[model samples]
Target: MLKYGVTHRLSTTYHPQTSGQVEVSNRGLKRILERTVGENRASWSDKLDDALWAFRTAFKTPIGCTPYKLVYGKACHLPIELEHKAYWALKHCNYDLKTAGDHRKVQLNELNELRDQAYENSLIYKEKTKRLHDSKIKNSVFNIGDRVLLFNSRLKIFSGKLKTCWTGPFTIAQVFPYGIVELSSTNGPNFKVNGHRLKQYFGGDIPPMVVPDLQTFPMDQ
Candidate 1:
């Protein structure tokens, strides 16, 4: 209901599954009421009425309804004169649920199908990514000071911090296959980096260096 962010299954004593939006909201509302009813804290009920008024007037996105409208079908019609009015709202009208077992049963069935599909999809994506990584590794062989672009992706790195693109035209100072690539920093003379991180760039293949064979003189025995 809190939009499309990926929901998690893990809930611990320390990590309860609640949105920060709700948490901060309650805290702020309480603080506002506490301030307005300072010393006479018991009169917070009066301040809460004003807070509710303020909250209802605020705007929200995606659903495009204020808290007031979400609870009540329409905005509160504030009276300029001393007449008190009651705010009324219509219930959320969507028929997303039915009698007893229907909603739960349908949801359970849908989730089961999603879980199975996710498991199968996971394997497919895993193998595809692995093949890509292996192919790159097999084709790549880095040498010193060879500049190349880094393949940056949080999904690929899994660290969620590595640059997804445009990290280095970093120079390769050393090479260690299947592991690290010692790279030189783009900075001053003090800069250096991992060998495995370095990529080799050929400035248009300058044909492999050829060497001439020299015949050795035979000595008389």
Candidate 2:
């Protein structure tokens, strides 16, 4: 990648949001493979090419175009187009070597514009998605000296079903902007954690209940 001047980004462990696009693509590919392989699970490798072609040719809402079209500056010719002698198929079939070369050059020249438009469309789509997500998020408010429970996300893998994942009645030592919180525990040092991981801890002493003495009349004994 360095040889090609491409920059590489590493995502943090357990944080899928850092690489959301790659995660979504993997999920889509898994679904496509599942549908294509059906009961022939062992033949998934054989159907890989078909699955890839389908994915590349399918329209993406974010980009507002097929992946193949964005990369090649033209839509892919479907098998049906060849079988039915579509206009695109016939136009390319009649082109001589020089004519085909010139046509390809024209497409390559327009490739940059196509990519720019796709980029803009993707930005708009992401903005709308972020807005929708933000609309449903209820902002958590925390104050200094308040008690809160810290969620132990790391315990998810090996913990038993009945085990509680929340680990703390930590005191909120400081509240920072952008969902950052500093917490202090009784036996541990103060530390900063994401505010989302903390929830208001309502732990306190419960009042003792008093029962009045009951007087019984002489029984039938």
Candidate 3:
């Protein structure tokens, strides 16, 4: 895949869940692996097949169906179906070629509609997630001359323990949409940063406001 221009991404870094669908799949896969492995930590590799099978057959809420059913247009007959002789298993065991062909034809005809429904469901889920995420966000607003502190998240591994987390009382040079801000330091170069990582600076000197004295002169005379 890499040779063909397909690149693999590593998670657990900044914003690990880059996409909703991929994050959901990762969570489900982890849950299945945890349950299947139980106490056998070293035998996780051996139980990988069981975890994968469970995940593929399990119903997903966003898609509103199992992955197996979506791809094959039929639910897979598990071992339990054979052991307990379920009605579906029994009926399919003696299933005639003509009936099977008709069933497959119907599935093929409805596949497009099923896929469309799944796509709509995914969009709904994404919108709900976006609303939830946006609800917790408080936008940082700054004007062109406002002084702000920028958070330092790129600390080196061997840096001193007492290093400050914030490093600037940068002047806001420009403001852009989607939390983007251009900053200029007192003695350093100007740079662009995300507004989320900046806070209003209160360390600079301020001039006192002058108030005008009120005069109550005799106006009746």
| Top candidate, metric TM-score | 2
Off by over 4 Å in 3: 1-13, 38-43, 91-94, 142-177, 180-198, 204-221
Of candidates 3 and 2, the better by lDDT: 2
Please report the candidate that would top lDDT against the real structure: 2
Ranking by lDDT: 2, 3, 1
Residue 98 lDDT (model 1):
65
Span of ten consecutive residues with least summed lDDT in model 2? 9-18
The number of clashing residue pairs in model 3 is 0
lDDT of 3 by residue, 20-134 (tens): 6787887888887887786768988898888888899989898898889888877788878989989988776536888889888898899888889988997898889889977
Q: Each model's C-alpha lDDT? A: 0.54, 0.82, 0.80
Candidate 2 Cα lDDT to native? 0.82
What is the C-alpha lDDT profile of model 2 across 103-171, one tens digit per residue?
888989999999999999988977887788669767889999999998776634566879788888999
Which pairs clash in model 3? none
TM-score of each: 0.28, 0.67, 0.65
Residue-level error in angstroms, candidate 3, position 46: 3.4
Stretches of candidate 1 off by over 4 Å are 1-8, 61-63, 81-221
Q: Tell me the alpha-carbon RMSD of every candidate.
A: 17.0, 7.0, 7.7
Worst 10 residues of 3 by lDDT: 9-18
